[model samples]
Target: MTAYRDSGAPPAADTAGTRRPTVVVITDLIVLAKHLRLLDAAERRGVTPLFVFGPETPADELARHRRDPRHPLSRLADEGLRHVADTSLETLLRAVAPWLRERPVRAVLNVGEVFVEAAGVLAQTLGLPGPGAHAARVCRNKPLQRLAAPALAPRWTLLDPARTTAAGIRDAFSAFPAVLKPASRMSSSGVRAVAGPDDIPPLLPDYGLEELLLLEERIAGREFSVETLVRDGAVLWAGITAKDTNESGTSFFTETGHTSPAPDLTPAQEKLLLDANTEFLRAVRFGTGMSHAEFRLTAEDRVVLMEAAARPPGDAITRLWRLATGMDLDAALLDLALGTEPPTAPPRRRARQVYLDHPRGHLTDVTAEDVPVHWVAEQGRWPDLPPLAENAPARGHAVLVSRHRGDLLGELADSQGRSVSVVLDAPLGTGIDAAAHDATGRVTIHTAAPSPAATTEEPVG
Candidate 1:
């Protein structure tokens, strides 16, 4: 094993020549589970994993992990983890240049949204293979993505919130039922649908003056996310995921469930989605790493692009893919970042993730039952449920797997009303509709009923 020093000094001479190729990971926060997977993958491939913490990272947190003998970070050589005062490209270059000179860096990667741009810039600056900073910038800016592939997206315009007036916006998009949202936000934050000029002003205060907003005609169709691995700008593998959202709520868009290997999609729809994704990747100049591209299939069979990111999809989609298919998406992404070929495999099973949401009020307890399929995992908070909006935080989540597609969906439907619910009259599965015509179709949970308890309760098996 190669031992690194924290004093900014190069590792001692590799007398035995046993040091493995090193890959640098830039992250804003330390997710222990994710890092453990990365470390194990690197070890299996005979590579060294070096973690670089950003300036904003809590030093005490890292110190605590470092001091614990059983923690993964403690297993690394003394110099395995390093912290810098600034995350700027120049600062990073100055900080890591000496270390790189000592040990050749195989790749530079980032999984956090905030550090995506930095990862690209550093990889390019260091003469490593990556999508480059331009692609990263396009991935972060949704409006720019639409512009890059206008033919694949709905009619849209980017507006400066400070200068754009409600009247001007209405005039520009006189069409009712247009969608307005921040140009560069995640988790559907600040997204809204407006019927006219009167509906625009009230939503403006929710956004910041400096934030760029995108106003566009909403496309009606089934929304799906295409997860692909690109090598040298060509897609090696593509998986489509069918999405379910809270459509009945007028306030915000909240995801309800997602089924992978979207069994319902026709062959033509799948082809269109994959083809459009390839074009979108090319337009964005994404060269390598995993790309998560979202799109909608209209009733008229039109394929409209929503946005693409040069990273793995969140919400445990990677785990879902691994269950449905024999592919380890996280490992594949790591391989791509390290300039190695990723393995490809076909789907062998079906997997679905359902997010349980309760009505707004004190959450007394959460429980799951009558799940007819193989249960994979469940996680969330309970008992102390905070006030929740239509897009409230998930009360809990469950992952189920099966060999048959029908069994998965059947189990989902069967577990609906009985599996998860709040004390209010609104049941978990009530009014939850999946539509082939619109991506925003959702199950609306009415929270008009009062809460019976003030304390939270652990999830019942």
Candidate 2:
């Protein structure tokens, strides 16, 4: 492993007109493809985006991205894509030294979950704004977040599946209607709600024995997530996102939909949720960066944190925020990273994204009956959305369908199981909930039941 050779000299300052300002972006190809808005924002700011890919990134995938003219990576500055031998802190720092050796970096930002800690370290080492190293580490692990901010977390306990069985844990702790979650997994994978002691045994065998899990008392209440942007230990902007999930009558807690600037929240309730989130950020010692923190507002008015991530909110929540508040979160994130003042605006409208469900079978076709729709059979392809209106609502819905013909439709076990999503924006005081429902209702998913012969006929000699 090579160590970074720091020259003990300050980073070169950008003289107003003489030097060009550049920001380093750390991400893999998959995330890069999904977030084209980042490139748009960088262009708007006249800031160059320098790219860095981890050593594990497949060369073929990188080449494919470069070949695509529309991909963000294709438009990088000359010699912009810096290569790192490995993601180790030492190697990463050494790899980017040549770029920062002359021009001072405005920011070192990470777009997805995979490289939070690395970006944090990079920002700190270069004297730029970022979530501190400690905060980044804490955000990646669920149990760590619980321990970091005990006051905000629900009653939770940890267990090592390799060392014990479901019955063993059930005997030790009998908290009914509790949630079982993997310590470090994302997207609701391996996350289940145990109704009672008996439910534990059935669910425990599905997880790898080597996994560490958390059992927590499920707080009964409305689900919501707080999207926060912070710099210098202070909140620059915060927005609440209302969440809908499949946990109502199901064992799995997959998120079904989300709405930004969560409508119908009273002043006191909004204050409570935002205040709790701020306290959690303070407790974690979050220095800078965007945080997507989820919470449950119980009937008794307690804001219990579900978890938090040190990155932009996923599942199109950022897009909804942009539509609702007329704020380009991607642009704002860049501004925050560069130490420039990020603009802010109160929510003038409500924007929502809802995922549609279908029966389990072989997929035949999915179509929109009347309303215009965007179908995505291929991965990493985004719809060309209309521009955000300055005053009125965007006045339309953007729908995305993920599956293609011949794809298998499975049970709704997690967030990944759902394939269709709808996004709509409306003027303030309008009940977007119904609009979302109506938009989804207009789409039809046609499926053919699986053939028994396919399942029964196995390879035989």
Candidate 3:
């Protein structure tokens, strides 16, 4: 999210040209991907990002990076974030010694979910505004969320993964069909909802119950992820995104395309949301920086706050901000962290980000009937995929982009018809192989588990 804030604005023009302050994005792949646009803006303004990563991140999992000659930015992984527990503070700081000394990194951006503790430490030493230990302890801890949420976002309560017991589940089973989630988990990775206490034990091992937990009171509402760039008492550039998640709705990352300019909220509600965001940050003393927050609006007109992250939105929500508003959020984030006035006007563009999803089928052999299809695993550009994987699912998506909002879906659906589906020799589900439909087909297929108990969600807008 901080990445897109840069837009086309030249790098900090007010700073020293020879050795401009650097923005250190402490991250893995997604963090780096989020910064691509900022890199472009930085290139125009004359700034280089010193991105660092850890080795624990798989190369395959890290979105593909190409050494294209034409590209202005160069990303080099330093495998530091992954080893937070082992690396000493001085040793870690010394790793980026060159950039720290040369560029004198003025602002430190914390995008890594697992590195909040490390980030807070870094920010304190560097004199930056981020989720320091006190802040992180308050935000990430399940116990804290339970205590604070009722007043801040009255509809919600914390769900402690550690203390959530069978008795606790039984007592609340009638009124609240509790959703069990890890207190520290960023996404829906370990979030699950069981109707009764009986379902609790089976989930302990996978949910990592070894740690403290958050047994949040399940709020019946429409889910929405809010992204805000807070500077001083104002939310400089704020945007709301529709989040599509996995079956558990717990995927830390979104898996489907997000439409910008979220529908359904009345002008009053929108203002309340924006105002509540600023006020909440004010309570936290969130003076400056990007913050990602998720909420659910109930059937009763109650607005809820789920989790408030003290940084920019992740996934491609960064792109959504750029598309919805003309504001360059990355630059705004840099400015905010550097104590400079971040701009409120979003950049002008109809931007959209779509995650390619396949039905519940194992990957089979996939091949494009046309020449080949390019996949955007990240914000940057990629030439084309080599070929569909051996088990790539038959029903998949091809994210498309266009300025015509009304015709965007039509265009995508049309372009989808251009590609011919290849036949697969595998079975369905895990065995589902690669196969393409005829020239006439939709560009993408969204998958949801087939459950008799599953309920459909009404469009919030």
Candidate 4:
């Protein structure tokens, strides 16, 4: 269930003067949901934010779409964009390229980096948007991000993957518990938190993979992400957020939403972050769209830049901006991409997003009455939270969304607490194995949610 146009055609121009505010890259809920939040913000302000894309997917996908935590395509806006289904990205560029060439889409905001980089090329090719492919590479690569940080936020060290060693990694950060991460992968793809001499292996991938990783002195204090809009080397309308990261794996974001307007900082600290972000943006040279800038509110109260992506936060944190702060981060991002006025700066109150998760083992069952439920795909992705392709030991877990973080976490904890872990009676063996058509406990035990007090049952031999 994607927010797409079924025409099976690429995005092309429809009317002249019709502004292309911003084109979202990944239409998954996490990113696209921000667009919806912006649209919601705009409608309140009486301005119709416009961008071009495919039309709505089928109704069946609606449930699947809603079930996904990332985003639920606004059926209301579906009619706005022509539905072009079963299309490829290359086709999309081809269709969009020709039309935008004549009109010049004005500004292209890329929510997805791959698409953003691709879109950046298109904009550069059309001479309408941000930097070209050359700049896109520098903005995306980690080693580059590290090198560029000094110009923006903190001062850090870089390690070449090929020649770097464990001893070097330790020496690089002066033997401090350093942060190690892949220069290219997304989410918790290869990010790790290494404490001391012993915690290095997990952080360092030895066998095969890119060697380029940053040995950063893991900063202490609150971790927040700053969402920035860069226009030709300038950072404008920087919105900061206290990010919610997983307890153990620091890379993977378990849940996000936002606290409206973000906690205000001391005037001086705020200015410093603003200054750093501006410098970083200049170094990256992103002329349009959004970027996720990670920073640490250090014990010294200084903002330390962790990482910056040429895109928005992957999870639907923007949605929280809407509910908590009343800011249309998506729309603002769109305008930023199109070089327009701020859209996400609208007024918003308290906001937070949380997920219901199973702390351990297999999920015997999950049920949501009418609301919505979804699985956290490999590494806990929102929309496409598909289980490990096949019978891969259900390593990851599922996520359920709620309006507030407190409620979601509470429900998740409670639900997980009640969930039967192994349900030992049903191993993938004996007559019970693959008993797809059975109904009784032997070969036919069906799916059901047990009362919280239900007793553990044993199978008769």
Q: What C-alpha lDDT do the candidate models reach, one value each?
A: 0.63, 0.77, 0.49, 0.47
- Give stretches of model 1 more than 4 Å off: 1-19, 30-32, 55-70, 83-87, 359-453, 456-461
- The digit string of per-residue lDDT tens for model 3 on 67-126 reads 544443334333212222122355446555555654567667666565555665787677
Q: Tell how far residue 197 is off in model 2, in angstroms.
A: 3.5
lDDT score of residue 270 within candidate 2: 99
Encode model 1's per-residue lDDT on 1-461: one tens digit a residue. 11221565556543376556788877644223333567778888777877777764566656666677755667766566767776567656655676697776888877666667778888877777777888888998988898889899798877776777777876676656778878877767677777766787777777898888888878788989999988888889999988877655544555555666776778988999999999999888888888888998999999998778877775556766765565766678788888878999766554555655433433223323322222211111112111222333222222222111112111121122123321111112222232211111122222222434342333321
lDDT of 2 by residue, 150-249 (tens): 8888887887766666677777776667999998888899999887666766676788888888899989999999999898889988999999998878
Q: In model 4, where is the ten-residue run with the lowest total lDDT?
A: 420-429
Name the candidate that leads on lDDT. 2
TM of each candidate vs. truth:
0.76, 0.86, 0.68, 0.61
The predicted structure with the larger TM-score, 1 or 4, is 1
* lDDT accuracy of residue 353 in candidate 4: 38
Order the candidate numbers by TM-score, best to worst: 2, 1, 3, 4
lDDT of 4 by residue, 67-93 (tens): 555453443343234333423456456
Q: When superposed on Cα atoms, how far off is each prediction in RMSD?
A: 10.2, 5.9, 12.2, 13.4
* Candidate 2 global Cα RMSD: 5.9
Off by over 4 Å in 4: 1-30, 33-107, 131-135, 151-164, 168-175, 202-208, 230-236, 247-258, 343-348, 355-357, 361-461
Off by over 4 Å in 2: 1-19, 53-62, 82-104, 362-365, 369-372, 375-379, 384-394, 403-406, 446-461
Error of 1 at 149 (Å): 0.5
Identify the leading candidate in terms of TM-score. 2
Q: What's the candidate order when arranged by decreasing lDDT?
A: 2, 1, 3, 4
